[model samples]
Target: MSRLIYMGFKLLEPYEGKLSRTVLRGESGSNPADLPDKAIASPLMANYILYLYKTMRKFWGEPIVVTQELGDILGNAVIKDSILASSDTICLLDQSKFRGNYEQVAKLLALNEVEQRKIFTINGLDNKAGRGKFKEVYIKRGNIGEVYGVEVSLFQYLTFTTEKPEKTAVESYVARFGSYSAGLEAFVSDLRSSRLGLADFIMQVNAE
Candidate 1:
């Protein structure tokens, strides 16, 4: 058997390029002093999830978990305890799709009648006019829970969307400027100048 070991600085480099030292070295100013607070968050880093969750809490940092399906947590032993138990705040989007099997979810999250009502009320409110399309979310911290409407601008929508075509178009522009933030700024400027809606702009890009 042969071995390829990357020790020392080689371990700090990203797969293709140099890792950003700002977040890794606490140079971002928002991070803790002289501590690698970011630690390059990745799905593959679940090996140390429990440790990360415990230590981060001790340092006044939060560890968040996001999943499309509740089964991802309820079905797993490690996550069912480590992540779910340690999470103090819970955020939920529209969960009407899980109405049939929601009792388990309710029990798991320890939701009371008020909290359960709040969860079902997500995206069920009468929003004001000219506010653009948006969805509501339920956020529960401690014992109380509240539903808040989430409405973002066009640029923010593109930035946050998970659709393949939209992401592809966004990345195409990102590649041009060699910086995601700068590229996204340029994309928004050009999109506005084109005077087309987001759907129309996406269709035009996909066609070309």
Candidate 2:
């Protein structure tokens, strides 16, 4: 998906679709670290990418690059020289998995010790006593960055959750209420009134 943007963005430029955002998500599966190297080494790709951002910016477009393979991306020429330079805001999930090579990430992103600490502290704070199961994200803009906890409502989480049992619980509500949206509304309302934890409420639904 990410690599195709260099090839496809120009094709869409003439039509001028009303797309406000462009997302380039890297392949997160097991693969060689040099995969992006192969993608960016093409002179054709480099030339296409040079003009890609101009067209996107013309329509107030924001390009977001999502990659779990930071090792591959940081080492790749296109990301280091092109994408990173154009990107002003960077949102990072937990970097614990990359602690061994975090120095490269810091150097590439120009993060100092304090900002680096914020990246490491993603989901590390001991503040989840009452909050729902959530994750923390580190968003850095220019220089300073802060870690923010991300909590979602039962409806929101359940709507997108891929777990079969959990999805079945949500679907049961959708079945009873006639529509997914209204079912989500009713599900949240019932969960709120019951005062049960989300898992417990799901268990109750499963039991029924």
Candidate 3:
């Protein structure tokens, strides 16, 4: 039996549903702020969730937890009266096995530099027992990219910068003419628009 306490914006109606269901997956629980370390946890890094919740409260009403009937799960947690939502993030608390797997998945996702930089940053990294976690955003991608079978020499020679906040390094790639997008439609458009081969495309981007 594992438990998770997550924070998400109430302003986004779609996300409220998604976040609530996600947190209730097992013998889980939630807290408005941070929960104790006995359980694994990850939080969002930005306050964007707070801004959305406050701005959209009138139309969507206050964000809330949906009732899911389960034994000893969904423990009592307070709904804070304050406007500043803590972390505006998602936290997962679960059994050791699930926690390990979850952290690995988070790491894998974070490896996708564009998505990682856009959504979350690697605040803390550890492989220790009973205390591994990563913070991320609640924002869902409005678009997804597809591989284009194109490659170019100049595109292959661009070197990626190794600088502070490496996650945003993809932005530099974009500045050098790399096209990355979340919208599938836009992605398809860009892919079709390109004339480079797949290997050459990666090489060009990597060189940048």
Candidate 4:
């Protein structure tokens, strides 16, 4: 059986009424006409997510599974829409999804041993050293599957720099690693190289 890889991002900061009304305007089952023209606007995070979706698709192909923590403030409708736009297969991580006393939802979601080994999670570290450390330890424990900590700031910087130069920092740093990717070219190169692990993993699974 071919191993299935799942990739997703976790927002470090919770979304608390930050999404602009503009993006929420055309949402299904929502009436935007009732509100004023300037009443709603999209948040910067939303734009970042859109860019991320495009990058993931362009580089890694469409994700077989997109997951978000249950009851997480960051798991809003706009984010869900962005995830769904890339792939229809969505897995909302919640307590109920787990069987028995298992706390690791990823393990429960895995259909088989190959699937368990193939799972990869990209956590939005947001420059938090402690969170990155925790993920490192968690991965070392080998109970929750494979986890990758992605610096949220680096992603934000790359997104803004790609769109408009001179706005974001020149040196983008990966959270907790003290590694920096200088300039757009270096950033793109590093990002692609880092994601190559996923590609390689998938390739190995197919070869098997």
Candidate 5:
């Protein structure tokens, strides 16, 4: 076979297990790393289909046939669209990343303490770290860059003053709100302010 053909085969061979086929050969016999260097796809041009195939096979199983003629369903399958749209539900908790004119966000938020607290959640979402204890207030923008069909253009500014301000508080605040609309609003507001010491404020907002 031609070198290109060899390379293509090597790239695809590892993912063939994803297809629902009864294999005379061992179903799990696939190794892209075993191919010669010349048979490997370039990192930039690597096929996503092949990658998904391998990933699915590894995650799902060697055989995906739902032989359900006489079987009991175990659990519910998670729909793909639900996962995709779920990210939009996240809100901003920070008021940092908005520098210069963005200081106005803080001022605006402070103007209405009730709205400020409303934007700042007293409890955070449930995740690996457990439920969030404090709230955040921020503005939203678009995604900053793209990854996995998602664009990350949002920016934010954050503040969570307590009895004793700790670094972790700020980190948690930024992590929660740094990607949504409220965060972006805070960011743009600060950028437009152009006040003296604004650089310091920006640094403080995103310090962690």
Candidate 6:
């Protein structure tokens, strides 16, 4: 029984813009300025992933699997090399890698509607050409347990603020539409109260 934890968190804006271009880009790095605006924007996401990776390392003392989102942006060879240099593993989190027998369990326990929608979009299930492709491509590729693993865990770190004047985009969006959309605050409140129970549930599911 290998130890596995699946963790994820929403992207947050960094304080003070503390991550420098050189630090993020690494030595002998390409000038992000030369890249397209979209390419340049990805470094911030990559930096955040790195931050999470380091933070997780402190707790688990092990290498971990990460989503393709992280892998796509952290294209710098030096930084990637540094990550791989560690004794633990850092493999791509893909459907193909999932273990058998945990598929239904994952669908029932791991994903909510929002997450399912996101997965649908990621795998092009919503696209005309790719309609109904999610089951064929995504789910068939791996069970949730295989993708997240026992060592994998998700963390959603949101900086919520009621200060209307200083609200971030996400906060504003939630506030404006939360009542109609999905009771975002209520969900968070429930999550806070039931997190321990959720963890236990996951452990029990994995155990079986």
Which candidate comes out best when scored by TM-score?
2
- What TM-score would each prediction reach against the true structure? 0.56, 0.72, 0.19, 0.22, 0.18, 0.23
TM match of model 1 to true structure: 0.56
Residue 180, candidate 2: C-alpha displacement in angstroms: 1.8
Residue range 122-181, candidate 3, lDDT tens digits: 233243233312222233223332221222332222222243333233454445454543
Root-mean-square deviation per candidate: 8.2, 7.4, 17.1, 18.4, 20.3, 17.9
Model 5 is weakest, by summed lDDT over 10 consecutive residues, at 67-76
Tens digit per residue, CA lDDT, model 4, 9-109 = 12211221222232233222211112112111234444545554464445433323223333222334554455544443433322233335333434333
lDDT of each: 0.66, 0.69, 0.33, 0.35, 0.36, 0.35
TM-score of 6: 0.23
lDDT of 6 at 157: 24
Worst lDDT run of 10 residues, candidate 2, spans: 26-35
Off-target runs (Cα >4 Å) in candidate 3 are 1-60, 65-170, 177-190, 194-204
Model 2 agreement with the true structure over 1-208: per-residue lDDT tens digits: 5656444444545423323223123212211112243444444554454455555545455545556676546656766687677887888988888888778788888899888877888888798888887889998888888899888876678888998888998899999999999988998899899999888988999999
- Model 1: colliding residue pairs: none
Residue 112 accuracy (lDDT) in model 4:
44
Q: Which ranges in model 4 have alpha carbons more than 4 Å from their true place?
A: 1-42, 59-68, 72-75, 92-94, 97-208
Quick one: best lDDT, which candidate?
A: 2
Quantify how close model 1 is to the true structure by its C-alpha RMSD in Å. 8.2
Judge candidate 2 against the unseen true structure and give its global Cα lDDT, from 0 to 1: 0.69
19-99: candidate 1 lDDT, tens digit per residue: 133333333222221212222223233334555456556655545656665656677666676778778888899998887
